[model samples]
Target: MKRIVIALALVLCAAQPTLADKVAAPIPIGIAVAQTSNVALFGQEQVNGAKLAEERLNAAGGVNGTKIALVFQDTAGDEAGAVNAFQNLLNRDKVVAIIGPTLSQQAFAANPIADRAKTPVVGPSNTAKGIPEIGEFVGRISAPMTQVAPNSLKQAMKIKPDLKRVAVLYAQNDAFSSSETTTFQDAIKELGLETVTVQKFQTTDTDFTTQVTAVLGANADLVVISGLAADSGNLVKQLRQLGYKGLIVGGNGLNSPNMFPVCGALCNDVLVAQAYSPGAVDKNPVNKDFAAAFEAAYKKGPAQFSAQAYAAVQVVVEALAKIEKETGKKIADFELADLRAALNKSLRTGTYLTPMGEISMAPSGEVQQKDFYVSKIVMNPDGKTGSFVLVSE
Candidate 1:
C-alpha cells in the first residue's frame, strides 16, 4: 500500500504543468510584407532584412535565451490582401507581434485588425501621414511623408537655385503616393516654385504618354514623381525618352535598388530622399555591422526598405527583452495576450540605435528617428544597375 501511494504521487506530479507554469517556447513574430505583385521589389528587400535580423538576433540568444521564429504571410500589395494576412497572423499563427504589409494603403486597411485585437504591429515601410494615428497598438519604423519627402525637393532647389516651375505626378490609387505628392506640392509652394502641372496615374499603368505630354506642354523645369517602383520607374524612362532635361525628384517609393532595371540608364541623376544610406557606415557602428552583414548575404549594399525592416524586427525583439527584464518574468511564461500588451507598452519606452541611427518610439507609437539622407542615382554603364550616391545628409 505504501509503494502504491508513492507511485500514484509521482504520477500526479509528472502530469502536464498548469497553464501558469507552461512556457511559450520559441516566440513567434509575424512578418506580413508583400512578397508578390508589383510591390514585391520593396517587399523582397524587407524580407531579406527581417530574415537577417532574425538570424543575428537568434544567434545572440534571442529574448532571454529563447529563440524567436518569424512567421511570414504575404500581404500582396493590396488592401484585401493585407487584411487577410493580418487575420491569419493574428488568429492562426498567434504571433506576439507583427512587422509589415509594405504600403501605407495596406496599413490603413489591415492595421485596425491588430489594433482591435490589441496586438502590436510595426510598419517597416508604411509612410503615409496618418499611419501612427491608426491605433495605440500600431507604429512604424519608416519616417512619414511629412518629414522625409521635402528633403528631396530642398536638395533639388540646391542643385538648381533658379528652378522655377515644377510638375508633380503620382499614383492616384496609392495612399502613399497621394500623401507624398501633398508634401511635394507643399514644399514647392513654400519654396515659391510655381506648380506647372499635376498629373495622376494608376499604379498599374505602363505608358505615361498622356502624363509626359502634359509635363512637356507645361515646360516644367523640374518633375517630381510620387509612385511605386514599376510606375515610377516607367515614368522616369518615358520622361527622359521624351526629353525632360530638368531634374527629376523621386519620392520615398523610389528608394529601392529594384527601380534600377525599370528605368535603365534613365534612372541616373534622379534625386531621392533617403531614410537609410550605406554611406552611414562610417559614422554609425550599428550601421557598419548591418552593412557588412547585408553585403555578405546579398552581395550588394542594403537599401532603405531592408534597413527599415531589420530595424522593425530589432525593435520588437529588444522590446520583448525589455518586458522580460521589467516584469521579472519570462515572456514564455506570460499569457500570449499579456505578453503582447506588455510588449506594446515596453516598445514605446526606449531608444534603439538602429541602422537608421538612434530611434525611439513615441507614447503614441510613432518612431522618432534622428537622421535622413538625400541621394542621387548614378547608374552603371550596364544600365541595369546603379547606386544611390550620397548627395546630402
Candidate 2:
C-alpha cells in the first residue's frame, strides 16, 4: 500500500507544469521593406542593419528574457505590394510591430493599414513630407525632406557662394522626389538664387535627353537632382554627357555609394549631404562598433538608411523591454492601445545610441540630432570609389 501511494504521488508531481514551461514564447517583429526593386540597394542595407540589431539583442538575452524573432516581408516598392505585405504581417504573422516600407510612397499606403490595425511602425528611411501625419502609429528616424534638402542647398552655396540660376530635375511621380524638389526650390528662392529651369521625369522613364537638353539650354550655373539611386545616376550620366559641367548637387536619394556604378566617372565632383559617415570623428563607441560590424558583413560602409533602420529597431526593442519591466507581462499581453501610448511616451524621452549618433525622438515623432555632414564623391588613385573630406555644417 505504501509503495502504491508513493508511485501515484510521483506520477501526479510529474504531471504538474514546471516554472520554465510557464515562460512566454519569443516576440515576433515584422520587417516590411523593399527587398527587390529599384530601391533594393538601400533596402538590403537596411535589412543588414536590422539583422545586426537583432543579433545584438538576442545575444544580450533579448527583451525581458524573451527572444525577438524578425519576420521579413518585401514591399517591392509599390503601393499594392506594401498593402499586401502589411496585411500578411498583421493578419497571418501576427507581429507585435512593423519596421519598414523604405520609400515614403509605400509608407503612405501601408502605414494606414498599420494604423487601422493599431500596430506601431517605425520607418527606416521614409523622408517624404507629411509622413508622421499618417497617424500616431507611424514614426521615422530619417530626417524629413525639408531638413535634408536645405542642407544640400547650403553645401552647394558654400562650394560656390555666387551659385545662381539653379536647374532642378526630379521624378514627378515619386512622392519623395516631389517633396524634395519643393524643398530644393524653396531653398534656392530663400538663398536669393534664380530657378532657371525645372525638368520632370517619371521613375519608369530611362532616357533623360530632353530634360538634360532643357537644363543645358537654360544655362544654369547649378544642377540639382532629386530622384532615387537608379534614376539619379542615369540623370547625372546624361547630364555630364550633355556637357553641362557646372556644380552638381544631389538630394538624399543620390547619397548612396551605388551611384558610383551608375555614374562612373561622372560621379566625381558631385556633392551630397550625408546623414551618416562611418569615418566621422565622433567619439561614440556605438558608432565605431556598428561601422566595423557593417563593413565585416556587407564588405562596404553602411549608409544613412542602414543607420536609421538599426536605430529604429533599437528604439523599439528598448521600448518593449521597458514595458515588460514595468508591467511584468510579455509584449503579447499588452493591448494595442496601451502599447502605442507607452511606445510614444518612451520613445520621446529615451535616448538611443545609434550608428548615426545619439538620437532622441520628439513628441511629434521627429528625430532630434545634431549631426549632418557634406561629402564629395572622389575616385581613388586605384580607380576605386570613395567619399572624401567631410565638411562641417
Candidate 3:
C-alpha cells in the first residue's frame, strides 16, 4: 500500500503543469529582409524602421501591457535567401507574423511559403502588379506603381510642355522594374507623349554608355528610367555625363535617400514619383508623428521604404491587439495557427492611419492607401546630400 501510494503521487506530480508552462510570454514578430548584400541599402533602412517601431511601441506599453519581441532573419538579396529566412522565422523562432523579403521578385518566390503555413506577411515595398493576389496571407503597404507612377510623368510634362519625344528604359531582370516600365509606357501613351526609344538593361550592369548613346541618338526630350536605386542612380549619372539629359524622370525605385550617394549632384533635377511624402504631415497626424519620431532617431526624414516597413509592423501589432480583444486571450496564449488566421482576418477589417496616410488591407491581401505625391530631387552643392522637394499632388 505504501509503494502504490508513492507511485500514484509521483505520476500526479509529473502530470501537473508548472507556472512557467502555464504563463504566457512576450509576443514574437518576425522581420525578414536583406540586412546584407546589394539590397541591404534598402533593407537596412527597413531594419531601422522596424527597430524604431519596436522601441516606440514598447515604450508606450506594447499591446495592453504585454511586451512584444522582434525576431530578425536576413534575406540577403535573393530568392533562395528569402525562402530560407522565412523558414527559419516560422519554424525556429515561432514568430506569429513576418514583414519582408524586400524585392518584389523575392516576394513572388517566398510569400507563398508563409501563405501555405497560414502566417500573415506584410510587404513594405513590393509594388509590382498582382502582388496582393499571391494569397490570402500576403499584403503590402506599398501602392502599386500603376496608381502613383503616372502622376510624376504628368508632372514632368507639365514642367516641360515640349517633352514630346519620350524615351523609356528599365532593368529587364527585375520584376518590379519591368512592371513599373509598363506603367510608365502606358502613362506616356495616355499623356499623348511620343515614344521615341525604349531601352533595356540588366540591374547588375554598371555601364550605361550604350543606352545613353541610344537615347541621345533618338534625340529624346524626356527620359524615364526604371530600376533600383544603385542602377537607376548610375543610369542618371551616366545620362548626365554623356550629355543626354533633357528631363529625367525616375521610377519608384529612385525615391530613396540612398540614391543621393549613388548619383551625387547628378541626381538633382530628377523627378520621382512618391507613395509617401513628408509634406503629408498636415492631413495625416500619423505621418507627422512618425516623421518627428524618425527624424529624432535617425537625424533625417524617413524614406518611403522605412515608413512603409514601420507601417507594416504597426499593422501587425494593431491587428494582434484586435485579436486579443475579440478572442479574450493573450497573444502568446493563442494557438499559432489560429492566431495567424485570426490576425489575417482582423487586419483587413480596419483602416489604419499609418505613416503613409490612411491605409487598409483588402480581403485579397491588397493595400488601399489614399494619398500619393510627386517630388523633384534637389541636391546640395556638396553633390552628396539631397531632399525630395514636393512638386505635385
Candidate 4:
C-alpha cells in the first residue's frame, strides 16, 4: 500500500506545470518594418531602435519573468508586402502584438489585420493624419503630419517671410507623401501663400531633372519636398545641382542625418520639422537617459521615429508588467481581450518618458503631446554639417 501511494504521488507531481516551464516560454513580439525597399534606410534605423528596446527589456529579466522574443518581418515598403508581412506575423508567428509597418501607407494596409485579429498594433512612425481612423486596435507614438508640417512652414516663413510662391514636390505613389503634401498645401493656403507648382514623382525615380526644371520654371520662393529619405535626399541634391537656389523645406522624410550624404554641401541651409531631437534641451529624465543610451548603442543620434519606436515598445512592456502584477500569470496565456484592455488603460493614463520628452496616449489612441521643433542644417566653420539651431514653439 505504501509503494502504491508513492507511485500515485509521483504521477501527480509529473502532471503539474512548474513555474520554470511557464517562464521558459517567451512571449513573441512582432516587428514589421520596411527592411528591403526604398525606405529601408529609415526602416533599418527603426529596427535598430526596436532591437535596442527589446535588449533592454530582456536584460532586465523581461516582463513578469517571461523573456521577450522579437520576430521581424520585412514589409518591403509597399502595400502588398505590408499585408503579407503582417499576416505572416499574425498567423504564422502567432505574436501577441505587432510593433510597426513603418510608413503610413503600410500601416493603413496592415493595421486592419491586427484589428480583425484583436491583436494590438503600435506604429513606430506612421505620422499621416487619420491613422487612428483605422480601428481601436491601432495606435501610434509618432505625431501626425498635421503637427509636423506646420513647423517646417513656420521655419520657412521665419527664413523668408515674403515666401509667397511655394513649389511642392512629392512621391505620388506613397500615401505618407501624399498626405504630407496635402498638409503643406493647406498650411500654405492658411498663410496666404500660393502653390506655384505641384510636382509628382515615383519612389523609384533616380533623376529629378525634369521635376527640378518644372519647379524652378514656376519661380517659387520656397520648395517643399514630401517623400521617403532616399528619394527626398536625391531630389534635394538634384534641385541644387540644377541651379535652383531657393529655400528648401523637407517634410518628415528628410529628417535623418543620412540626408546629408545625399545632398552633401547642398544640405546646408535646409530646414526640417522634427518630432525628436537628442539636442533638445528638455529636462525630462526619460529623454536624457534615452539619448545617452541611444548614442552609446547606435553611435549616432536618434531621430523622431527611433524615439517613438522606443517609447511604443516601452509602453507595451509596461502593460505586460502590469498584467503580470495583477494576474500573477504569464503573459502568453493571457487572453487578447484582457491584454488589450490593460494596454489601452495603461497607455492612456501612464506617462512615458522617451527621447522626445514625456508622451502619453489618449483614449482614442492619439498622442497627447504635440511637441515639435524646427532644425536647420548648418555647415559649421569647421565644415562639419549638423543641425545648428532648434526653434521650438
lDDT per residue, candidate 2, 171-231, as tens digits?
Answer: 8987778888999899889989999999999877779999999999999999999888778
lDDT of 4 by residue, 55-146 (tens): 88788888867788888999997899999999998767777678899888788888998888767888888887878779887887788888
Angstrom error at residue 102, model 2: 2.3
Q: Model 1 over residues 1-393: C-alpha lDDT tens digits?
A: 999999999988884632422225789999999999988988999999999999999999999898999999999989999999999998778899999889888999999999998899999898877888999999988888887888888899999999998999999997778888999999889889999899999999999999999999999999999998889999999999999899999997788787999999999999999889888776789999999999999998888889999999999999999988887988878888888888899889989999999899998888888988899999999999989998888
Superposed by TM-score, candidate 4 places the C-alpha of residue 258 at a distance from the truth, in angstroms, of 2.9
Alpha carbon lDDT of each predicted model: 0.90, 0.80, 0.88, 0.79
Full candidate order by TM-score, most accurate first: 1, 3, 2, 4
**Can you write out model 3's per-residue Cα lDDT over 92-118, one digit (the tens) per residue?**
787888999799889999999999888
What TM-score number comes out for model 3? 0.86
TM-score of each: 0.87, 0.84, 0.86, 0.81
- Native-vs-model 4 lDDT? 0.79
Cα lDDT for residue 341, model 1?
85
lDDT of 2 at 297: 79
Error of 3 at 361 (Å): 1.1
Best by lDDT: 1
Among all windows of 10 consecutive residues in model 4, the one with the lowest summed lDDT is: 15-24
Give candidate 1 regions above 4 Å deviation: 1-23, 204-210
C-alpha RMSD values across all candidates: 8.5, 10.2, 7.6, 9.2
